[model samples]
Target chain A: MRKDSRGFKIAFIILLSVLVVVCFLLGNAKGTIEIGVKRIFEVIMNDDGSTQRMIIWNIRLPRMILAALVGVNLALSGAILQGVMNNPLADPGIIGISSGAGLFGIAILVIFPQHQQFVTIAAFFGAMLAAFIIYLLAWKGGIQPIRIILAGVAVSALFGAGISGTLVFYSDRVYGALTFMNGSLSARSWPEVQTILPYTIAGIILVMIFAQKLNILILGDDVARGIGLNVEATRLSFTALAALLAASAVSVIGLLGFVGLIVPHSVRLIIGNDYKYMFPATALFGAVLVMLSDTFARTVLSPTEIPVGIVMAVLGAPFFLYLLRR
Target chain B: MKNDIIMEVKGLSVSYKDNKVIDCIDLAIEKGKIYCIIGPNGCGKTTLIRTMSRSIKPQEGHVFLSGSNIFKLKTKNVAKKMAVLYQSNATLSDATVRELVQYGRFAYKEWWKGSYEEDTKIVDWALEKTRLTDFQKRKVNTLSGGERQRAWIAMAIAQKPEILLLDEPTTYLDISHQLEIMELIERLNKEEGITIVMVLHDINHAARYADELIVMKDHKIFKKGDPWTILESDVLKSVFRVEAQITKDMDTNKPIFYAKKVI
Candidate 1:
């Protein structure tokens, strides 16, 4: 937001552009029909009925875009929650939002397998419900961050158990549910992207518009009120917005863990806590982080793809531990 | 409903769970005066101030700021008339003095719009008033406790409000830093005609700096008058449960108290 940080901004922009290009080229572009960057561009320019064009157009491109969008949603959601809750460690998953969405996702996967298209909608409701429950539980006098977190831990464990019990009884769908729970992007197509696109865009627009308020909100609720912020209304709306974003991501990605947690924390280290810069920066950085990690997950084993959640946890856990020590 | 009344509360009562923290309190604060509320730890001083600022909602009654019901008005509109510095300031992760002060101008600007030149000028003026002009770019966390308190006050000052509410503005500071904050507050009241209502822990500081004092006992106003008129040993004993020597300062002609023991 200041002139002094112009160089860093420009550098990060360039870095993000390069990473976007790399992600587009490498996403699912492996195995027997590996498409080169030039070939990928040619296919994008002219889509034939060939398998190569199909891989680039119908499969990899959509997957890549969806990954990036999910990253944007999750990171922005985390950034806003961290600000609203006034806690750096807050993320959608840690606060039980992702798990709440995950419960609905598993329900759809198991019970309403025929109505798989309803997963995103169900997840949104579930996420909002979780947020509402957390808010309600934390409402002894007013919502305290510690209480929300404690309630979150309790609620998350509840949802986690629900997911486990559902899977345990319905062991027939365990493979699909396990992959989804581990947060894989395998076999993901344009429909999944279409499902979350409008919500993701809407969430981003809302966050960008309200980013300045988020900056004030980080100053504590009472201080925010002093500055004329309708603290309760603003916080509720932002929480709903955050829940919507995280739920959208969860429905498609199946409870991806650390994109929300790591991206905002890392971006704050680069840019300060001013949400004007921090939100956008978190968006770009989160997209790149997820895209790159997804690429690694796909190519590292070459056809035996690992889950992106595993990749993120491998990368994020140490960073989290280090931050904790600091 | 006096014309000079800037902020007035009528029959205000606030309850937390089952306990009534502030009970049926009525107060009318005249414009351009420094009023301090002093009592023991749990006498609801903070709650009363918070209710007046609309930070705490009363169970029954309304707070009128500039003749408008504070809770009924839009938050930004109420903010234009009064700004409050709550006791526990939210810990900012990384905020420069300038950026923190810029938040004070939030009510003036649209969400999408940048700070106008006028806003910038006011922010600069606020920083200068708090003697933090040179430290504008310094992160607030990096400042000393006294300096951080000044930053918070500067942020409030940037609101350009007629009334400023401070809850224990000098709780954690050393004696000299306490004096520094009290002096700054006194100067604001005198020079800018800012009506200040603060909850103070120290009886002497309240008596020395405040033009008027509201002594609270058992969730009610025990007494309200000029510090010189009300600073008696019996009032101190009943209100704060302390045995004290009340003396007049020859220089300031204000009442000063020396607490010998907590009775």
Candidate 2:
């Protein structure tokens, strides 16, 4: 077991390095200019006010970094929620958390367009609200995974309908809302990266710190309590942290689906279920998965970018089905 | 009353929603004794154990551990004093036996700390005690029912508690495996001097293993005494509603009961 885990760790680190190189090259090379890896690195180092340099620094780098951060956040949150809730299928998007944030994002965009700064905060509250409702509705003695998932599906539909209603009602300001609703990394900028950075760092740190607790949590609540965990309190705090992660990502990247659902599951398949390793492995792999998907989304069609969400869904759905089959 | 009691339940009544599962009852568990609670299904044996372990809060009354109210103590402090093993050892996350047993050291660990030498020593001791040393690296899900149950016991033993509470520890095991677990638990009580309170479904097993017997009927304690004294034909008929034949084991001097039919 020890040797197998150590092997997985080494392989994961090598994979992450390769992905970083690939992500940097794809982000810098493919757009309109088609710069080489050598030129991209030179431009980054020299900064001679050329078009390629401007594109690399201003547009592609920020977008790539945002995608990586958002992916890590979503994946870590998913891993934590799956452990705490003891549900393999738990994810921010599928469990109504992202939709709740999406509704709040739309509300801010439509109703209080001037107060754009409140979107992240509102999204956080909205995510927590959805989680609270799902948990409360699922509570019949205790929250079972099946009950919570069913409640989440219901809550997702409700909030999804609310988002559509807002979009239809405010058709005048619909263009930005339309693209944002589909989960895109298009035209992502430094400001968006800045918005999610603090929360993402803090949330990831908190998840790592509580990784051992999460390991205990997956043992079921009774066992968790038996091992000295304050089960309810640990669960509540972990749920809130997961909400914060998904809300932070959703606020920046719109409603990206399946990144949270699939990344951790795949990571677990490779690294095993010990959360101490699973947490970091999932975060890195999630970043790579999204970076590669975003690279595909932007370059596959070239000059006309598809939503990264579409790319993720196209790739993730089949993998999810395969997991179910297994 | 206070001299040798390791655990005390006073006026404990537990309910679920509108239905009371465990009516008002009191129990004092002496140190280094094996106590078994036996009753029919849904007669509140598990509920009483759950309440005693602080997994479920009683609607009324207090459980005192070493003269302190257990509910008022921090969870880690309580865990240091007592460990519980419920019936189901199922988990969504699959772990090796070593990893599962390592979790028992959570109370002694800080967030940033990894396993210390002391933790490893305790975990090793637990694995040895449960005879799981060879299976330490085996995945828990792949183990047979008896081995998996022993893994759970190893985890509880790893906690190194003075008191251990088990809810239906031998429910689904084969007779031989059940005897194995009972002997292991008895050794813990006798050699390690750990106070054990367990809910067992089999009356014969309880009579053979337990130093003291608690017979529950209709959500209340019908009788509590030494198993040799309490495991009589009349007591079994009245409390268990079974026409029973009671005899003494010539070798061990313990009561042996054979139930003919439900009365």
Candidate 3:
């Protein structure tokens, strides 16, 4: 009999928004050369191209922005996947989508070095292919969550093997692929930020605009159809959009893990599954989570960094188990 | 003649995995009446109802709504004319009853604008009509079976349809809840003038609520008539394989049946 209180959801969103700002600032301040807010503002307000300014402007700022964008992409994609498949466990990272993107992304980088510019497009195609194969394998007239997850695990393993085989064959290029395979945020600058921003904005807008469809979809396909939805068409469009969002994020971050699973699931656990609020809430929470997790990844053993994907998995797998048991 | 026949099913047949579930069936639905299709389990009663609501695509033949092919019309247009309620739905378990009912206004939503005061009024009206106004704020899964059924009915009626289709609407309810649902269906037909087409497992409930009874057996219609003529002992034993004694309800003067051993 628990009610979905609008005030509670709006207030929680406000709290998450506040957390996003806090995460950004924490990420900005904590590092080898820790700078106070006043010093940071001083550099921003008056840039004389000093060492601190370079550290803030060239390194920390862009990476933080990229982290936030990845957060938005993964969280929104996860939200859509949960709706499209009607399963809570449908994360891009866990469901072979990231593996698909990684395999295609690495292939573009190492195998076809000349056409490396089409890496993002190749990654998207791979992700779509992975999604289609999973759907084909999992479908017994309808998408069951367990079947999809099992199929995803198999596809993910297969793609992981493909990535491994590619690296061994092209062993000379393994150096660059290491950070990518672990989804690190080290040394990424403005170019990475620029690569991910447009996709994030596009994914967010589309998710908001189609939020109502997700709500209708939760009512089951037959009822959704009876209520005038082109049920099959809606499912296809949303699934593709989910894959595209996840692929674009992976194209930039290269196999980043579990912002999808953790952020959206936690948000829904708080706000419930009305996508109108859940999408935006999940987006904001995602920004906070990744920025914070990246900060933790960088600072937990300062000067010696851990990959943010490791941080996310250490946090996510346990939470996933908790949900499964519940 | 065509105008009075609000929906016409012509040579409609549906198959599942190459096994025919619904044989070619033809029936005409007159406007502003309650019709019930009754049969044993797996007799294609559910399939026929689904086909009529366009939930299932027939393998052959056409279903015409308002003398136009239903398949040709836009989905929203069909939804606006007819609304179907199912016995079970893949509901977001946490959704509030009011929120679920509000989704029924989906067809009226434009590309730009979402909702209006008019929609709110209709939603509230639906909640009131279903006697679920008090429970509208509560989660759907937390409600009792009867209350949940009413909530679904509220959502369906909120579509503001001229025709309503329900597939085994009271199959899972207790006897008291079943009576409540039948009375509610009767009210929706009599008060709102909504043409009702429902599939029911309970013959007595159908005999009481249905103005016309369509008895189905083995994917084909066994008999079709007014309940008084259709609920006789011979038809019941033939269609249901039961020795059913027909009786009259003392208060409502409707035909009721008591069935014993199967044939």
Winning model by DockQ: 2
* lDDT of candidate 2 over B1-263, digit per residue (tens): 34499999999999988988999999999998899999888889999998898888999999999889999999998998899999876787678899999989889887567559999999999999999999998989999999999999999988999999999888899989999999999999988889999999888889888988999988999889998789763677888788888888998888888888988
After superposing candidate 3 on the true structure, give the runs of residues whose Cα lies further than 4 Å from its correct spot: A1-3, B1-3
Off by over 4 Å in 1: A1-6, A28-32, A48-50, A108-117, A168-175, B1-3, B111-115
User: lDDT tens string, model 3, A76-156?
Assistant: 988898888878888988889889988988888887788866888888888888889999999875678899899999999
Residue A285 Cα positional deviation in candidate 3, in Å, after optimal superposition: 0.9
Interface RMSD of each: 1.2, 0.9, 1.3
lDDT of 1 by residue, A171-190 (tens): 79655777767788878889
lDDT of 2 by residue, A1-326 (tens): 36445676667757776876687577668776788888878988988999888988899888888988998999988998788777788888888999999899778978898998999999999999999989888888666878888998899888888988988999786456666666899988899999999988897788778888888988988888988999999999999999989999998878898888899998787777888788887888788888888878988887788999998888877876786577
Weakest lDDT window of 10 consecutive positions for candidate 1 chain B: B106-115
* Candidate 1 lDDT for residue A18: 80
DockQ-based ranking, best first? 2, 1, 3
Q: Cα lDDT for residue A105, model 3?
A: 84
In order of appearance, the predictions have TM-scores of 0.94, 0.96, 0.96
RMSD of each: 2.5, 1.8, 1.8
- Say which prediction, candidate 1 or candidate 3, comes out ahead on TM-score: 3
Tens-place lDDT digits, model 1, residues B1-263? 44499999999999988999999999999999999999888999989998898878888988999889988999998877799998887575577899999989988886557558999899999999999999998889989989999999999999999999999999889989999999999999999999999999888889898888999989999899889777863787877777888788999988889888988
Judging by DockQ, tell me the better candidate of 2 and 3.
2
